[model samples]
Target chain A: MKVSFFPGCSLEGTAREYGESIEAVCKSLDIELQELSDWSCCGASSAHSTNEFLSVALPARNLSIAERKGQDLVTPCAACFSRFKAAEKALTCESKVDVGIPFQGKINILHMLEFLCREEFSEDIEKKIKRPLKNLKAVSYYGCLLVRPPRVTDTEHWEDPQALDILISRLGGESVFWPYKTECCGGSLVLTRVDIIHRLNGRLLDMAREAEADCIVTACPLCQANLDTRQEEIGDKEGVSYDIPIFYFTELMGLAFGNKGVRKWLGRHLVDPRPLLESKGLI
Target chain B: MELIGDKNFRDVVVDAVGEEIFTCYQCYKCSAGCPVSFAMDMLPHQVIRSVLFNQKERVLSSRTIWVCAACETCTTRCPNEIEIAKVMDVLRQIQQESGKQAKEPKVPIFHKAFLDSIKKTGRVHELTMIRNYTQKSGELREKLKTGEWKNDVRLGMKMFLRGKLKVMPPKCGGVKEVKKIFEQAKEHKKA
Candidate 1:
C-alpha cells in the first residue's frame, strides 16, 4: 500500500528517529511512503489557538498536495494527524466551508496508528514481529490528539481509544489499560514552562510506574520528548526516581520489522530504549 | 479576591462554556500543579474563580492566559472536567475583544511566529520560522539578553551552508486555498 506521509517539524529535528523508523518499518511491510512534496508545518500547538485559519490553511495545503497525488495522507506524528484532521474538519464544517480547496466532501487523513490498525496490516505487523515483546508490560499513552477533539477521529471512542492497546497485544506485548491513556502530556510546555510539565508528566509517569509497566509507548513526538527527555528534571522536581523509558510506537514496530537501521533510530532516544529492547532480545 | 455577588458573571461564563467551573471547589489543584503559576499573578484556579465571579478585568489581564502552556493537566485532573485549558482560551478571546492591553506574551510570541510561517508559506520551514520569530520579536535588538543568540547565529549559518534549512519556503500548490482560510478566520473574528 502506498500513502503520502506528513512528518511534522519535530520529526525533522529532535525526533528524526521517528521519521527514520517509519521508513524502516514501511520498507519491511512493503508499504510505499511518498512524503507530501513541499509540505509545511502543521502549526502543531501554535497556529490553532492564535489564528485558526492559519492552522487550517497550513494543514490544508498539505492535504491538497496529497489530494493532487491522489493518495491518502499518513502521518507518524499524532500531533500532525490531529492538526491535519482538525483542519479537515474546520474546512468541511457546513457553517463555514472553504470553497477553494476542491475537497469533494471528506479528505482522507489517516494516522499511522489508524493505517497500521487496518485488518490487512494487523496480521502483517504480527507476522513481522521477529523478537517477542512478550512479558514486556506496556502502557499505551494516546496523549490527547489521536483521540480527542472527536470531530476528526470518529473511528473509536474519544475517551478510551483501544487502537494502541490492540496493536501492542498483536505484537506479543501485554498492554495495561489505564484511565490516563487519553490524557495530555502537557503538550509543548517542556520548553516554555518546564515546571508545570514536571507535575503534568510527573503524574503520568508515576501512574505508569505504579502500574508496574516497563515503559510508556506513544505516537506523538512531543509526548515522547516530554516523557523521555524531562524525566530527570521531573524526577528532581517531584522528588522521585522515574527512570521509565518512553518508546515511539514506530521504534517498537521497527523491532517487529527487524529491518535495517531499526536499532539506530530507537538508539537516538535520550532515555535509552536499548536496555529494554535488549532484555527482550529485540535489539 | 472576594467572590463577587453577581449571578450574571456566573451565567455568562457557564453559558459560554457550560458547568465546568462549579466542579472546581477551590482545590487549588490547577494552581499548585500549573507550570506557569509562578509567572501568573492569578493562579489557574484563581483565574477560573475570577471568571466565575465576573472579575473580567482581573481574569483577562492576569498573566495566566499568556503563561498557560495549555497542558490540560488541570482540565484532566479537575474532578469537574472544567477544561481549564479551554477556559484559558475563552479568556484570550475575551481579552482580544476587550482590547485588554496584553501582547501575545513571551511564549505565545514564538507561537505567533509559527502561525505566521504557515500563513505565509503553505508549510512551516523551521529556518524561516526561527528567523521570522527572532526578528519580529526584536530578540536580536539586544543580543546580550539571549545567551542562545550566538548558538542560533552559528546554527543559522551552518544550516544555510549545508542547505539543510532552506532560505526560501518551498511553494505549496494550494496557496489560494491557504489564503482563503486566512481570510475566513479574519471574517469569523469580525463576526
Candidate 2:
C-alpha cells in the first residue's frame, strides 16, 4: 500500500526516533511512504490559540500539497493529524477565510494508528511480528489529540480509545486497562507552564503505575516526552517513584517485528526502555 | 460579581469561533473534564459563563485561556456540544487583538517564537525556537536570578548530544506559499 506522508515538525527534531521507527516499520510491512513534497508546519497547538485563520490556513497549505500527490495522507504525530483534520473541517464549512491556495480537501488524512488499524494492514502487521512480546504489560496511552473533540477527529471511541490497545494485544503484549488512557499530557504547556505539565503528566504516570503496567505505550511524541522526561520530577514532587518507561507505539512494533534498527530508535528515549525490555526477556 | 453585559464583546467571540456562545448552559462538565483546571484562575465553564455574561475583560485577561493546553477534553465532554477549546482559541485571539498581553506572558512568548520559526523556515527549528522563546520571555534573567540557568544550559546540551536538538533550520520549497498563507490570514483577521 502507498500513502503520502507528512512528518510535521517534531518528527524532524525531538521525535526523530518516531520518524525512524515509523519508516522502518512501514518498510518492513512493504508499505510505500512518499513524503508530501514541500509540506510545511501544521500550526498545531499554538496557531489556533493565536489566530483561527492562521490555524486553518497552515494545515490547509499542507493538505493542498498532499492533494497534488493524489494519495491518502498519513502522519505519525497525533497533533499534526488532528490539525489536518480540523483544518479540513473548517475550510469545508466556512467560506470567508480564503487560504489563498487550492485546498479543496481531495485526499483523506489518517494518523499512523488509524492507518495501521485498518483491516488491510492488520494481517500484514500480525504476520510481521517475529518476536512476540510475551511478558510485556503495556498501558496504551492515547493522550488527547488522537481521540477528542469527536466531531472533528471522528475517532471511534473518544472517551476510551481502544485502537492502541488492540494493536498492543496483536503484538503479543498484554494491554492493561487504565482509565487515564485518554488523559491530557499538557502539550505545548511544557514550554509555557511546566508546572501544569508536571501536574497533569504526574497524574497520568501515577495512574499507569497504579495499574501495574510494565511501561506506557503512546502514539504521540509530546505524550512520550512529557511522561518520560518529567517523570522523575513528578515522582519527586509526589514523594513516589515513577520509573515507567514510555515508548512510541511504533518502537514497540519495531521490537515485536524484530527489526534490526529498533534498538537504535529505543536508545533515543530520555528514559531508557532497554531495562524493562531486558527484564521481560523481549530484547 | 459585577454584571456588565457587553454584548458586543460576546458577538466578537461568537463570530470569531463561528459558534453560538449563548448555547452554553454552564453545566460545568467542561470544567470537570479539564485536566489543568487546577492551575487555571477561571474554570472552563466559568470562561463560557464570563463570555455569556459578556464580561469581556474577565474572559480575555484570565490566565485560564493562556493556560489551556487545547487538549479538547472540555470540548469533548461538554453536554451542550460547544467546542470550548475553540472558544478558548477565539478568546486568545481577542486577547491578542485588544493588545492585552497574556497574564501568563510565557505562553504568548512561546506562541510567537513558534510561529516566527514557522514563518521564516516553513518548519520549527527547535534550537531557534528555544533561543527565541527564552530571549523573548526574559527567561534567561529569571533563570539566572534563581541560579538555574546553568541547569537549563545543561539540559539543552544533553539534548544536543542525544541528537534530538537540531541547530540548523530546515527550509521547504513551499516557503513562499507559507508566507502567503500568513499574509492572507492576517488580511482575513483585519477584515
Candidate 3:
C-alpha cells in the first residue's frame, strides 16, 4: 500500500533512527512511503502553546500538500501525527482562513502504529517475521498524543490502546500488561522543564521495570528521547537504578523481520538495546 | 493574594480556546489525571474555576499554565468534554500578550526559541534552538554566568558525537511557504 509519509522535524534530526526504522520496516512489508513533498514543521507543542493560528496553519500546509497528492498521510512520530490530525479537524470545522494555500481535509492521517495495525497488513507482517521474538517481554508505551482527546485522534481504546500490544504479540513477543502505557512522558517539556520530565519519566521507567519487561517500546520520538536519555539522571535523582532500553516500535519490527538495517537503527539509541536483545537470544 | 475581577476574562478564554469553560462541572477529573498537577500552583480544575470567577490575574499568573505538558490527559479525561489543555494554551497566550511575565519563565523562553528556529529554517535545529533558548532563558543565562552550563553543553556534545544532533540546519523545500504561513498567522492575530 502507498501512503504519503510526513517525517516531521524530529525524524530529520534527533530521532533519525525512527525514520530509518520506518523505512526498513516499510521496505520489508512492501509498503510504499511517498514522503510528502516540501513538508515543514508541524509547530508541535511550541506553536500551539503560543499561537493557535500558526499551529493550525503550519500543519495545514503539509496536510494540504499531502491532500494534493491524493494519498492518506502517515507519520511515524506520534506528536506529528497528533498535530496533523488536529490541524485537519481545526481547518475543517473553523471558518476558512487564508493560509497561503487552500486546505480541505481530503485525506486521512494515520499514525505509523495505526497504519501497521490495519487488518490487511497483519497477515503480511506475520509472514515477514523471520525471527520470532519468543520470550522477549515488551511493554508498549503509547505516550500521550497517539491516543488522547479521543474526538481528535479517534483512537480506539484511548486509555488502554492495544494496537502496539497486538503488533508485539504478532511479532512473537509477549506484551506485558502495564498501567503507564498511555502515560505522559513530559514530551517537549524536556527542552525547558527537565525537572518535570525527570519526575514523570522516572515514574514511567520505574513502572516499566516493575513490569519486568525486557524493553519499553515507543512510537514517539520525544518519548523515546526522554525515557532513553534521562533514565540515568532520573535513576540518580530518585536513588534507583533503571537500565531498560527504549526502542522505537519500528526498530523492534525491523528486528522481528530479520532486517539487517535494524542494527543501524538500534545503534542510534542513547541507551543501547543490544544487551537485552542478546539476553533474549533474539538478535 | 491579589484579586483580579476582570469580567471579560472568561469570555476571552472561551473565545480563544473555543471551548466553553463554564461547562466544566468541577469534576476534578482533569486535575486528577494531570501528571504535573502536583507542581502546579493552581490545579487544573481550579484554573477553570478562576476563569469562571474572572480572576484573570490568578489564572494568567498561575504556574500551572506554564507547566502544563499539553499531554491531553486532562482534556481526554474531562467528563464534560472541556479542552482543558487548549484552555491552558490560551491562558499562556493571554499571559504573553498582556506583557505579564511568566511565573516560570523558562517555558515561554524555550517556546519562543523553538518557534524562532522554525521560523528561520522551517525545522528545529537542535544546536540553534539550544543556543537561542539559553540566550533568552534567564535561568540558563545565570547558569552560563556561573559556568554551570557545562553540564548541558556536555550533553549536547554527547548527542552531537552520537550523531543524534545534526550540526547543520535542515531546510524544508517550502521554507518560503512556511514564512508565509507565519506571516498570515501574525496578521490574523492582529485582526
Model number with the top TM-score: 2
Candidate 2 regions off by >4 Å? Answer: A94-97, B1-7
Per-residue lDDT value at A224 in model 3: 92
Q: Worst lDDT window (10 residues) for model 2 chain B?
A: B1-10
Ranking by TM-score: 2, 3, 1
Task: Summarize candidate 1's per-residue lDDT along B48-74 as a digit string, tens digits.
Answer: 877767787677667678767665556
Compared with the true structure, what per-residue lDDT tens digits does model 3 show for residues A105-124?
88889999999889989889
Task: Note the residue pairs that clash in candidate 3.
Answer: none
Which has the higher TM-score value, candidate number 2 or candidate number 3? Answer: 2
TM-score of chain A of each: 0.94, 0.97, 0.97
Give per-residue lDDT, candidate 3, residue B11: 72
> CA lDDT of each candidate?
0.71, 0.85, 0.85
- For candidate 2, give the docking quality class from DockQ: medium
Best by DockQ: 2
What is the iRMS for every candidate structure?
Answer: 4.6, 0.9, 1.2
Cα lDDT tens digits for candidate 3, B113-186: 99999989988887899888877786676886899688777777767776788889986788898888778777
